[model samples]
Target chain A: MIGELELILCDIGNTTFHFLIDDVEQKYFLNERLPDFNETIYYISVNDNATANLKHSNDDLVDLEQYVNFKTKYKGMGLDRKIACIGYDDAIIVDAGSAITVDIMKKAKHKGGFILPGLKSIKDLYPKISHKLQFDFNTKVNLDKIPLCTQDAISYAILQSIIEPIKKIRKKQQIIFTGGDGEFLSKYFENSIYKKDLIFENMKRIINANNCIA
Target chain B: MIGELELILCDIGNTTFHFLIDDVEQKYFLNERLPDFNETIYYISVNDNATANLKHSNDDLVDLEQYVNFKTKYKGMGLDRKIACIGYDDAIIVDAGSAITVDIMKKAKHKGGFILPGLKSIKDLYPKISHKLQFDFNTKVNLDKIPLCTQDAISYAILQSIIEPIKKIRKKQQIIFTGGDGEFLSKYFENSIYKKDLIFENMKRIINANNCIA
Candidate 1:
């Protein structure tokens, strides 16, 4: 007779740490709050400095570069990206979080990728120049051509900043969008599927495959 | 018989005010250091407040939206943009200054336009997030795909930001690029021509046509 499997998976990001255990998911800030979990923690981190401060079995951490099944020429692929690519075998995976990553995975192989500032990050960055330049995500602006007003102009610019790269990469391939702004930006893409907790889903696969065992 | 034509043409922009008179060109700060020129300035402005401060005869300043020969539905179109599109009768006029304006004109008609932050402005905006994000204009980067390093990624993003819009607007039309960063961005664009002082050139035509007399 076998007992129930017990495991704790954590994706240590730059801002927040996402945790999944026994199909229950929770998130905490990397700096402000720390959860009370006692299980064997299997983790993948984008921020090494913050991850180092945490207490975990060193061997249980997932090496994203080695955890993947496919081969990649990019030596500096981040942990978040490597996990996002897992199971998304043959599609363009776009992570629109703090940073927008447009990584092309054609036939289970990483062709290439791009990283640009996210919608929030760009909106935040632009305010330093002119406080009037604001991105209203709720404001529906047409992308068929240039927008007229400042708000719409900014909204369109931010949208194009993300979409243009995907268009450059999308050659009739399915696009899988994930991240904070994925829900908002995905609607604009014709052939895109928005999936939340993608990193957590990838983490589950990685943990189940015993890839997190260092 | 025509007399020796003399005029002071001013381009009131977001940041600086560019002035030209009888082949003598000068610029003044939009806020801090005003120019010492006392000539009756024939001007077009994006900054109405700044233009209001400057002393000009009632008919000296040109109404951009009304002065242009072509018709446009965009009510808030800046004067600099209207002037840039003057001589570019049948082409895409891209002005990459404080703001990158891509206005498509076909057969002497305004099709539509896009507005994005300029390269310098984008570079300036990025540093607020991470001081490490330094934009070295001298560094040449590959825009075929997303770059690897942070600096290269940013460089590629900024370059892509400009190039991608032009690609979308381009439909076998002659591309005319002019601005502070126009010379730099023009190299990446194929079959494109870079022309400096395009606004000034357009201003000459506009003033001679008595568009400012309105």
Candidate 2:
């Protein structure tokens, strides 16, 4: 078995590289200097540039995509998303980052999933539409009541657009929220679990199951 | 009462000028040469440059923002939205143009409303996120079931995000759909009416009510 001290898991997205080391989380931008660690890093990357850059470096890296055996019907699904769904028998996994991906797993089999623009994406979108629509989204706005002002209107729209479909697809399955914006979105659900170390935890599981470590 | 033949109504948005004359609708690009018409035109515009350009011309034009007297608490609400909500007493008025505006009216009193990025805005948004996400939105995708493919996933997200909120806010109040994408969105709801000339019809009603025409 791989000791906790020797295990390092990295999830590289389009803009950032997130690392899990000995129960501690560390994050760095894609363009930032790589951390020099003696341990072999088991990583799954969605960014091609970052993947190529890391492979060329001296850091002993093991690409974990080969070991993920989740049965999903979603073709061209992101590696990060598939990794997050590991060990779940039944769940609605929501990875809310630059893009919010919602996937349903039943009896350890991936049913299907959909994606929506994240909060930052929606926030950046309004200004391009019109100067009048250039307002900060009020995330605290009450969703039950329709908005009376522009700020709330925009806020309500963003929240409702994301939350409603999740509620529609949900049926007694516990929603597992992960990624950057996961906690914020999980607050809206009653039977949802916010797992900050979801991907890394599952990565560790995959590492143990496959006996990849020496 | 002003005869329909004598009244010329124009709803000017950011990109195009939509005119209703003698029950026939005509559209023109904002950059295109202005139509030379003999009749005095009564118009409501959300585009500042188009409004300024029209005002500078020799054609007789009347701005209709001053004539609307609906009671609403929504501050900085667009004149086009307010004009569309003119005739509806108890309904959810949806204007799905460049931006989708949803306003609720209860017994001639404007309760509240919200704004959402329209279909075109969402379509343009995907390619910017990632080239892999560059797929045309499938409007006919079944919103009742979660999507399995990327194309259906995107299409489901757009439709569900827009439609679900309208359904949630709806409680026997007839949903009134207007604007460019109004007809497309209205098909999802049972208790909804698609009014292609909703703004123009309300503009004409305001003219008749206020006796603006001499």
Candidate 3:
């Protein structure tokens, strides 16, 4: 809890607007109008439209991108991904949202990362290839064995494909899973931590560091 | 060579009509008219439109789906995948065309398989998710390390995701890489055989067994 900071934090993505106020979390769709709030909202957004909407509203807004001073060699990295890595010094950060962004943080600096189509994106893609390929992923799929059926096969390919590279790259570091699908994906890994409010927590850290309680 | 058999084998996919005549391979786009061949062509197709087109053509065609006697518990398996596993008694058959189908053939019996979107499908998907993800894959990406750039990261995820599962399932069995992308994906694996004519060779085996050289 960010005691006495009295900060209302917002993390906006392509689809949803996530807000945390007075230690209470709330979510709103991007299309919906911004909620009327009395407190100033400090926010980071990857969506330009959302940022624009928030700026035009009568609410007090502080764009937090200016407050982040993280170091990384990766270019064109998403703002949400950058903020998520703020407090992690040595961890593999897997943000599984509309897109899964896997980044490596070492010695409190960004070591770079990769992006994969999220579970929903992958699910939507299969049927576009062929109707025969259309099947829901078996979420409880056994990744250790090669699947013999179509459903399990698709599930294995989707899950194992994402899991293997993370396993390969992880060496003596705890994997931190965040974002929407993070909980579902974290089940397959060992020595991993799932923190849904990772971004918000880091957002609070940034606020504390900058002392931007104005 | 299908010596003395004098057979013309065709493999029809969604995009191309692949023909092997007198051991000479030729390819024609699906939109183009079928070649005016004199010899009777034996073929297996996963594309309904192509199958219908060939049926309406003047060319002599034999559908080999009736001749296959393979055993598997998998339902709704594509005819193309079934035929590709014809002669491989113990191998991981990877047909890397528009869709990469990985099947295990054990003792000349089907043990079922899984499917992944081909490289092109994967390449096309990234951009649809985000404009930042629109970069072309680094074909020569080093999969051993976590990539520090966007291009290598996407490439590693795409390539390693596919490779690791195939390696995991393969135990003392040869990995047979076929289809359009077969030769390219084969470079990452050791003790893997790239058989461009795998489906055609298997088709010939079916022809020999059935003695349908009428």
Q: Which candidate achieves the best DockQ against the true structure?
A: 2
What is the TM-score of candidate 2? 0.94
Lowest summed lDDT window (length 10), candidate 3 chain A: A1-10
lDDT of 1 by residue, A7-113 (tens): 67778877777777766877778675465565567777877776875553243444444555656876567767878888766788888877787788877778767
Assess each model's interface with DockQ, reporting 2 decimals per model: 0.39, 0.79, 0.67
Q: Which is superior by lDDT, 2 or 3?
A: 2
In model 2, state the lDDT of residue B43: 92
Per-residue lDDT of B19-86 in model 1, one digit per residue for the tens?
A: 77776777778675565455456677777787776753233344444556656776556667778887
Worst 10 residues of 2 chain A by lDDT: A1-10
At residue B214, give the lDDT of candidate 2: 84
Per-chain TM-score of chain A in candidate 1 equals 0.85
- Candidate 1's DockQ is 0.39
Better of 1 and 3 by DockQ: 3
Off by over 4 Å in 1: A1-6, A56-71, A125-139, A145-151, A211-214, B1-7, B56-70, B124-139, B145-151, B211-214
Q: Give the candidate number with the greatest TM-score.
A: 2
Interface RMSD of 3: 1.6
| Candidates ranked by lDDT | 2, 3, 1
Clashing pairs in 2: none
> How far is A158's C-alpha from truth in model 3 (Å)?
0.9
After superposing candidate 2 on the true structure, give the runs of residues whose Cα lies further than 4 Å from its correct spot.
Answer: A1-3, A33-38, B1-4, B35-38
Candidate 3 lDDT over A1-214, as tens digits, reads 3576677888888878898888899898878887678779999998898788877763688888998877778877888889888878899999998778999998887888877778788888888887778787788877766677888888888887788778777888999999889998898888898998999988888887897776
Q: For candidate 2, write residues A100-156 as lDDT tens digits.
A: 899999888898889888778888888788888999878799998889999999999
